[model samples]
Target: MKASRDDDPRVGLDGRLSWRPAGAADLDAWAALIARTAAVERPVWFERREDLAQILESRKNPTAGNSVLGFDVQGVARAYGRITKNPDGEKALGFGCVDPAWQGTGVGSGLLGWTEARTRQRFAADAATRAAARLRLFTEQQHTHHSALFEGRGYRIVRYYSEMHRPLDGTLPEPILDDGFELVPFGPELYEAVRQAHNDAFRDHWGSEPRDQEAWAFVVNDPLARPDLSAVVVERAGGKVAGYQLASHDAQSAESRGFTEGYTELLGVRPEFRGRGIARALLANAMRRFAAAGMDKAALDVDSENPTGALALYLKMGYVAVNSSMAWDREF
Candidate 1:
């Protein structure tokens, strides 16, 4: 069905539901809805309420070219859908949540439908630069209902991604590194280098768009970004990005959800530095950093089908497959 716009009661069934931009005033209530919904559904990853608030505040800024649509009834936000425009100008809809108490009342569908229409309209106006309009979204594999909802609205699964974990208590093998190339703390100076290495490594992979300087800087400066948990480069005598790793404590939400595990979010090695033990060295560096930070264990996810042999390398670094998620795609 074609989505409706323009202050029409058609935004939802009856005149009870309406759509509007999300604002700071709605974050507390929205987050409460998320917490309650997650407690009954899948894993609860968000811990700090303030952290979630900060993220929501960032999303509210339209200058970033991102938007949040909320379904409000009698002045209460019951559901929301957010779309963030990636560097490629593709709208990646993420983090949609609705109050479970209102699930079957048409709230979700309304929020989703409105967001899609707005996204399609916005992208359509930019046809001169990019002929094809792209709208992509992802959900956990266990979210059968979510996938069904998207598929019902013409969004097809495009790629399957898996989330895997390994126990840090297990004995780990030593990592061999090139002489004089040792793990260093991540700092302002190395942010660009790390970004470059990751961009280079992911250049040909699926959806391999690299983040711009501002995006990378936000990460390096984020309160959630822990320098101690990161491993970085110092020298590249062989003309490669010697090594890199990014590890961090569970985000406030994750920690509050009772998960204290650390995470290795990114690890990269330049092509010229591959096979010389740089990757393994970086992995070990991340693990040790987490261990020293008093975290009993650490975990990192990798694409099982990563073209860079990441899965095998992670396994060699004492990681074992714990859980899996898949990406699915169908053309519109």
Candidate 2:
């Protein structure tokens, strides 16, 4: 399919819908549309309005120009698409969804076309900076329709990720810090330090780019962030972060799903600190904190092929795989 022109606001939905770049004013409608799509496509989790707002407001994301929303004749949002480039500019990630009622109606295909064209424009604008680039889209394993759509467009599965959960009601492991290291409560003072440590830790991980201050702050300061449940491992002598685990609780999800869950949003251990049990210790510490906070379960997602053997560690830590997703990429 040919991508729509960058300057075009119409997505060729057979004139069934009007299209425009999504803005702050569309947060409520956009979130409602996402919730509806999630109920059918990925029922396990959904982003809240606040979460959507952050993405739209992030300084690193050109949301105004890169995100589009399609509305029906009644002015109800029916489809959405967004493209965001990584800090390194080597890859652009695509996110979008169509109302379940609108599936198979060509709305999704048109959204993808717009995002593809926008991604190409972005890369072309920065051709001097990057010699090669790619566009990636993610879909759950159960969403065969989405996979078919991507495959039909020449995208190929490049990686898989597992979403794991462990009941906090069971016996929890005790975190044992390695010699010369200690676990401390996460605080605003350690934000920069943890950011640096995280970037260093995931440097070799697939598709990971260093998080700039704006992006790092967005995660650490998210409304749902639970600093009380997060921990930072530091060297006793120098107090430099060696490993870290950040967590969040979605009250809205708990209310809807009938169970409280503490999500491990980010976890990492610097390569120099690997094999010293820091990663395991951080996870165990967070699990205990979640249980102490009256959470019913601890949840996290991990790259299936993590070089650090993180998936094995989580499995051993009693985290059972609940669902999985695949990443598909079209390289340019």
Question: lDDT per residue, candidate 1, 1-332, as tens digits?
Answer: 66446533225432454655555676676667677677655642442355445555452225123434345555665666666555355444445677677776766777666556556555655554363545566677777777778788877766666555655565655655767676667877777878888887777666656777766755665556677788776564643456688876754545444555667777777766677777777777666667667665667767656787887877766677666554533221
Give the per-residue lDDT digits (tens) of candidate 2, residues 1-332.
77545446344443687888889899999999998988777556666688888887777676788888889989999999888885456788999889999999888888888878777767777745464668999988998999999999999999999989999987899999868999999999999999999899999999888899988988887989999999999999989899999999988787667889999999999999899999899999998999999999999999999999999899899999989999999976
Show the colliding residue pairs in model 2: none
Estimate TM-scores for all models. Answer: 0.83, 0.94
What's the distance in Å from true for residue 237, model 1? 3.9
Measure candidate 2: CA RMSD.
2.7
Off by over 4 Å in 2: 1-14
